[model samples]
Structure formats: C-alpha cells, structure tokens
Target: MVEIDGMRLVQTRAILNYIAAKHDLYGKNLKERALIDMYVEGTTDLMGTIRVHHKSPPKEKENNLSLIIERATKRYFPVYEKVLKDNGQHFLLGSQLTWADVQLTETILMAEEKEPTILSQFPLLQAFKARICDVPTIKKFLQPGSQRKPPPDEKFVATANRVFNRK
Candidate 1:
C-alpha cells in the first residue's frame, strides 16, 4: 500500500499505473497504453509464477524451480525476444521507454534470479539487459545497498508465511 497525504493506494497494478502515469512512463496515448497493458499483464503472469515459488512446499521447491524455468524460457521470454528482435529498438515499443519496457526488464531480472544464464539462448535479450541496466536510474538501483529487494529468501518466505498466515 502507498499512502500520500493520507490517501491510500491498494493493489499492486493500481499503484504501478499511478506511478507510471505520474512519471509519463505509461505511454503517449491510448494505443500505446493498450500495448503496455497487454505486455505488463504477461509479465505479471510470469511474476505470479515466480511468486508462487515462495509459497510452495519445501519438497516442491525443485519442481517449482523447473516449472518457473520452463515457463520463462519457453512461453514468456520468446514473446519479448521476438518483440525486441522485430522492433530493433532499445526498448520494446520504440525508442522511448515505457511501462512495458520496465515490466519486461523487471521480469527478465526476476527470471535471471532463478537461472543466471537464462538469456544465453536469447542474444537480443542479452543486449536488452545490457542497455536497460545502463539507464541512469536503473544503474543506481542496481548498485549494492540500494533499496531494491533481491528475490525473497528463506527468511523472507518464513516471515511472509507467518505474517500472512499461510499454511
């Protein structure tokens, strides 16, 4: 939840959209928003898969990992790979960065957290990672000690399960 001036924002996508619009990252118009929304939805699905890993039974972790790798490699990555290859732009949509680009960058990073060499088969995506990482704000955030949270670990999972009362 995000609170500003006592107004609260709940729901992840609502906060994302609010921030994206505030920063002019959503898109220039309706058509661009439609595309951004679609791609972001795909990334959200991919992220949801990864999120589920945190909730999996200990014995299921390996299977969860394999499933995550499979979905990212076979289903999701190929779509962005094709988009970046066909677009020939530094970002997904065009020259300027959009929410779609950010979401794609985020999903790529999350997938790589599971498999460091995940992009080996996608040369274009490797290039995209390099380019996105070089962006000033992103570069700073990538530095050690930044507020960026790494993928949840055992401790985080434990706390989340306890706090949320998950089985």
Candidate 2:
C-alpha cells in the first residue's frame, strides 16, 4: 500500500495510475494509451517469471535463469525490437516518453542481470536501452546511491516468505 496525503492506496494498478496521471505519463490519446498498455502488460508478464527466478530454490536457480533469458528473448524482446524498428521513434509509443518506456527499460535492465549480452541479438532494443538509460532522470536513478532497488537476494525471499507466510 502507498500513503498519499495520509490516505492509503492499495493495489499496484491504483498506485501506478495515480503516479502516471500525476506525471502525465499515460500519453495524450486513447490509441496511445492502448498501445502503452500493451507494452506495459508485456513487461508485467516478464516480471512474473523474474519473480519466480529470484524465489526459486538454489538447485533450480540455473534453470530459472535460463527460462528468464529464453522468455525475454523470444517473447518480449522481439516485440520491442520491431516497434523500435518500424516506428523509428524515441520511445515505444513514438516521440513522447510514456510509462511503457520506463517499464521496458526497467525490464531490459533486470533481464541483463541474468545475461549481460541479452540484447545482443536485438540491435534496436540495444539502442532503446541506451537511449532510455541516458534520460536525465533515469541516469540519476542508476547512480550507486540512488533509490533504485537491487535484484532480490536471499534475504528478500526470506522476508517475503516471513511477511506473507509463503514457502
């Protein structure tokens, strides 16, 4: 849950929509929103696989990593690569930077942790990653002392299990 002006907000979509509306990151039209939602949802799918990877047992870690790389390369990266290639735009929805761009950049970076050259086959995605990382705000967040959360470690899994009573 997130607290804004002392009122509590629950659910990920509510929190994200609040932020997107406040920052004007939702795009300017219905069509743009539809496209942005499509890209964002794709990344959301990748995030679920990544969560399984971090929470997997040590014995299965290597296999989980392989799955992440495979899904990312086969299912996700190609869509973004084609979008960037065909649109020839700075962001997923075109010239303007929307929430989808931020989400894609984040997923790309997380996937690279498993395989540094994950974008090696997708030149347009490589370029997109570079461009997105160079954005002023994003560049700042990438700095060492920033609030960017690191990949989930063993401790994170333990905490989640403890707090949620999961295995």
Provide the lowest-lDDT 10-residue window in model 1. Answer: 87-96
Cα lDDT computed for each candidate against the true fold? 0.87, 0.87
Candidate 2: count the clashes: 0
Look at candidate 2 and tell me the lDDT of residue 144. Answer: 92
lDDT of 1 by residue, 1-167 (tens): 89954679999889888889889999899988988999999999999999898778899999998999999889998988998877774788867688788788888888889889888888888888889889899899989999888999888888988999987
**Best model number under TM-score:** 1
Give RMSD to native, each candidate. 1.7, 1.8
lDDT of 2 by residue, 67-144 (tens): 999999998999899898777657887688888899999999888877898899998888888898999999999999
TM-score of each: 0.92, 0.91
Backbone clashes, candidate 1: 0
